[model samples]
Structure formats: structure tokens, C-alpha cells
Target: MPHVPERRPESLGQAAYRQLQEAIETGALKPGDRVSVNALADQLAISRTPVREAIAWLETDGLIVHQPYLGRVIAELDHQMVNELYALRFVLEPAAVGMAAKNATDAEIDVLREMIAFERSVLDDPIERERHNRRFHNALYRTAHNRYVISTLSALQTPMILLGPATASDPKRLLDAYAEHTELVERIAAHDAEGARAVMMRHLTGGQRARVSYLLNQQRS
Candidate 1:
């Protein structure tokens, strides 16, 4: 299991939830791994009640399933889950990017540029690379300045959070993704809402096809 640091938590339950979520996200808790409340409570240094609460929440998020007699199991990675993820992304991400193109301020655009500019320093660390990518996307969505959009997406378990590690683990795919982000940012900076939306649609469509195809073929294999 990953050593998930405690958050600046108000209650023990929230801290336990965040730590367990991080473990699942980083693949320290795998599909077949045992999820014992007693063991998790000891590991998190929290009481059983909080760990139980955390487990309940994760179960609702569909990350964990209670198997008959087998107890709690991490949900297996499958194409349907990945498709559901991309389906939501197609609906929300491009709309947010379109809004960002219309509404983003000079300062907000600069923030995105700086995020891209700082990428080279983190290229060696896979975890940092993933985080940087998330921050950039989060910043883009926030640039829309819509509270509802911000709140909804913030509450979501991102692609990495929903599934295990990234499907696009290839170095070349990572580079291509960075390029796609850059192009979308430039479109937004130009106040070309339609252009930005088109860029985002193309970006998501390519990823959806690739990931879905991989999973389907993997199942056959």
C-alpha cells in the first residue's frame, strides 16, 4: 500500500477517505487486493468507525464492490468504466474549454501558459507529470468562472482516480497529449471559442477510441 499522507482534515473520517482514495488511485490497492476494515484502520492510525465510513463512501463511488463471501474487492478495470469516463469527459471538458475561450482573463491564460512552461522540470517524475496534467485541466475548467461546472467536476473522480494508472502509459502518447493541451490553450488564448471546442472534441475523441480499442482487444487476448 502507498503511504498516503493525511490531509488537512477536519474529521478522521475525511482523512481516512482521502488516504484510501489516494491508495486506490496509485494502484497500491489493486483489483484483487483485500480491503479489511480492521487492517485499514490500523494502517491509517484511525478508528474503525472512520474507516468504515470511508469504505462506504468509496463503495458509492463504484470503486469498491462487496463480493459475496469474498468481502470487499476493488472494482475490476473494464471497457464500460473507461467508456463511461470518456462519455462524461466529452460532455463537460469541451464545454468548459469553450466557455474558457470566451471568458478567460489575461491572468488566467497566463496561469495555463506557466503550467505548460513548468512541465520540463517534472518530466522525470511520473507522479508529478500526472499531477501537472490535472492542475492544467483544472485551471482550464476554472477559467470558465462557472461555480456549477467547477463544483461538479471537482467532485468527480478523475480518469486516473476512476480507473487504475493511465491507459496512455506510452511516452509518445504522453508527448502527444501535452501537444494537444498546448493547442487547445492557444485556441483559448485567441478567444476562439469554436476553435477551442473543436480542438477539445478532437482530443477527447482520439483518446476515447484508442483506450476503448485497447481494452476490447485486451479482452480478446
Candidate 2:
């Protein structure tokens, strides 16, 4: 007989956090929308305690802000915020990729390739594709062998997730992104640190453009 692993049930706080996070990510909870803790708790069919806890956690991640009179609201993204975020990414991700070129083992590279394939297979499903996209970047972060870089990227995930409708949602953009990932992986496999960094810079710059365009379109709509 095969042994089965035990499954741990999610705590109310954890469940609330995930639901709230998804709402933010999909734009169901749009930026600048105020949060009503009791209202959300009632909507989730959970008590206020867990909902409050989730909000607190999100606040720490800079996903939600608490104003004196306005209460809690989703963090708004502007052109300046977008530029700052990408600038930070520019400083961090390229260096991480460069280090990954030197540090990632063949098995780690294989995992990244598998993630890319997974993303391609989910083209018809934006939600799954987005999940896989994050997974791929996270895999690369872990491959870098730097704890501070990994932690910083992890913390950034909250704000990053709030950017809805990925540029890869378009078929052409999806193909371009996949091609870029392929080239990046190739550069890493060859242990070309500088080449990997260059590819990463291009990738991030393109993504920043796409994100800005998406934000502008959202505003116009």
C-alpha cells in the first residue's frame, strides 16, 4: 500500500488572505477601492477577526493602506510608482539572473524550462498562466543563492500581483514572452552571466512598457 501525505486544512486567516489577494490580483478589488472589514467578512462567510488579520498582513506588504479618515484601501499605482517598481526590478532581477547563470544547477534550469512549458500550455487560461509566470521567476530567484535577493523579491510579490491583465494575455505578447524566456534560459545554460543580465534587462523593460500601457488603458476605460 502506498502511504499518503497528510493534508493540513487552511486556517481562516490564510483562506481570507488568499481570497483577498486574488480579488486584488484580478482587479475585482481595484486600486483606490476602500475595504470594509465587516463587509468583506460577511461576503467571505467568515468572521471579522480573520478578515482583519488578512488586512493587516496585506498592509505590511504595501498592498493596502490605512488612512486616518478613509480607512483601508487598495494601493493605487501611478506612472511614478510603476517606474520606481521597475527601477528596483532593474537593479535586482538582472543581477539575480546573472548570478543564476553562475549558480543554477542543470536541474534548476530544467525546472525553469518545465515552468515555461507549463505557461505555454495554459495560454487559454490567464489565471493559470499568471500563476506559472510567477513560479518561473520565483524558481530563478531561488536559483540565485542569495537570501536577501530572494526575500526582497518575495516581498515585492504583493504589489506585483495587483497588476491585472498580464501583457501575455495577448497571443502575440505571449509568444514574445515565451521566446524571451527561451533565450534567457539558453544564456543561463551557457553560463554567460553578462548575456543573461542583458536578456533580463530587455525582458524587464518590455514588461514595464506593457504594464504601463495596461494601466493607462485601465484609466481611460
User: Any idea how many clashes model 2 has?
Assistant: 0
Residue 103: error of model 2 in Å? Answer: 0.7
Which tens-of-lDDT digit does each residue in 34-151 have in candidate 2? 9999899999999999999999998988889987889899988786788888899999999999999999999998988887777778877777777777878888889899999899
TM-score of each: 0.84, 0.91
The TM-score that candidate 2 achieves is 0.91
Give stretches of model 1 more than 4 Å off. 1-9, 166-168, 213-221
The lDDT per prediction is 0.79, 0.85
TM-score of 1: 0.84
The Cα error of candidate 1 at residue 128, in Å, is 2.5
Error of 2 at 62 (Å): 1.1
